[model samples]
Target: MVIAFVISETFSIYSFNGIRIQAETWAEALMKKGHKVIKVNPWDKHNWEEYDIIHIVGPCEFLLQFTSSLVSKNKNIVFSPIIDTIQPKWKYKLVSYWGCSKLRLSCYNHDVRLAMKNIKQIYVRSQYEADYVHICYSVPLSKIEIVPLSYRISPCLHYPQKENFCLHVSILTSERKNVLRLIKAAIKYKFKLILAGSIDSEEKFRPIDQLIKKHNNISYLGKVSEEQLIELYSRAKVFALPSINEGVGMVALEAAVYGCNIVITEIGGPKEYYNNKAYIVNPFDIDDIGKKIELALADDNQQPSLMEYIQNEYSLDTCTKKLITSYNKIVSC
Candidate 1:
């Protein structure tokens, strides 16, 4: 069977990284099972009828549109609506208006309806996401499946030396991610913090740069490669990414796999995943975030065990098997 995996937009800065890993893993896993898999982003226009099934990843309005067109032509297709918080408010509107007409979500209202119409089954990274998707799109429980994104265990990637510094790997975006709040929390605790990822522009991220300069413990490493990020994850004492909203918070999983205790916003995916393993705090309350960070950082028992758990549950092999099984089930139906 020839399978086409479709992704259009670069949804999350980290999303592309996670999807790339999953695609590579899926291709290998399915091929071993005697299936042909080809992964393509939305812009790559291919003949949908050529493949046994077309799998569409979320955040690609184009792919959603394309899937609807194929379904209209009576083509067999399977969809993985990889919903995340990265879909901004406006993009939702645009897709609702121009992409799929006469579609409205009885539960989630506008954007989710537009997102849900073209797909058959929605694949989410967590049970939390599955529930949220059900609420948002009013998708039936049977249509949603939980298949967490997988990570490759690379030897080159290293964690921080000890729990001396708080580590955050995020985009330079401020509003949704609330990076400034983290800077403030770091300042309040007077703890060392290292930030990874590039600024869209130095002028645009002036406030972040200013905060980094103001705080002696805050070090901004602009746009490190994958190798550098893995090394930082390996050595970091604790990982903190207290975002205002998140779908799965892949960084938390990556850090957890590296044995770094997590401190994350208590809303969305973080609240669901970090129950027993890490610390949680309110994203808006700077003081609360600070206190949690301080506690996690100060804990001496932080070990590599969390990494073991993540590797076993959310590893590439695990996600791939689940996804392939989901695909086969959907096709059988």
Candidate 2:
């Protein structure tokens, strides 16, 4: 099958969000499964109808407009709406259906009706996201497929060396990332913390830099190569990313496969993936974060269940199979 894995944008070689990485990963996974996959962005000039299925990869106003156009032509299409909002569900319903969208206040609201229009399938990263899509867009439960971001284990990716530090990988300056709060938690708990990933602005993140200098337990490594990242994950005792919100927390998933005790935000879908294995904490509470990190540090058993669960449930092969199954359903219709 020829597939167009479309996204709002593509990732740069140095920087990207979850959506870009997932799109690239899916395209590669599909190709390995004997399907022809094309990486497409909204601005790409190719004939989109040439593909067997139009698989839209993320949510944006422009992408919604393009998807609806394909829907009008009766084109076979599926969606990976990697979207979420911490705002009240009532606000979404009000703006989407009750004419509040015309005010042009909320970026999400103006295009939600368009986003909710005819599509054969909607794929999401977690059950929380599935519920969000259904509630916000009024999409049917059956229409949404939960395919969380995945990590496929291989020989080259190293194993658990288990050092005594907590690892966090994200844009350090992102307000939603909540890295500053996590730093405070680490300091409070007296745990060693290693910060990774690209910093959007050194100037904006100077406060964090100062904190790193003042506290020996906290240190930022900026960004590291894939090799360095795997090594860090392999060495770290605990992996923590207590963000304000996450679509599925792919970094945490990656860390879990390396056998790092997971301490992640409870706000998003990490709970569904980790289940009872990893430490789940409130993103807004510093003490909760600290306490959970402390608990995670104490879990020295290196229980094989969390690693096995992630490997079995979130393998790239499993993700591709579900995606292909959904693709077949839409194309057959």
Return the top candidate by TM-score.
2
Best by lDDT: 2
For candidate 2, the lDDT comes to 0.79
- C-alpha TM-scores of all predictions: 0.80, 0.89
Q: lDDT per residue, candidate 1, 1-333, as tens digits? A: 788877655644564465555556677877887898887654566766677677766555455446556786535565555555545445544444443345522222343465466667777777766765676556789888877766555422334366478899877664767789899988988989999886666676898888899879999998888888878887788889788877677777777877788887777665565546778788899999899989988886655556566677776667778877877776676
Where does model 2 exceed 4 Å of error?
9-15, 41-50, 98-110, 152-159
Q: What is the C-alpha lDDT of each candidate?
A: 0.71, 0.79
Model 1, position 283: C-alpha lDDT score: 89
- lDDT string for model 2 (155-210, tens) is 22444557788999988898888998999988888899999988778797998888
User: For model 2, which pairs clash?
Assistant: none
At residue 300, what lDDT does model 1 achieve? 66
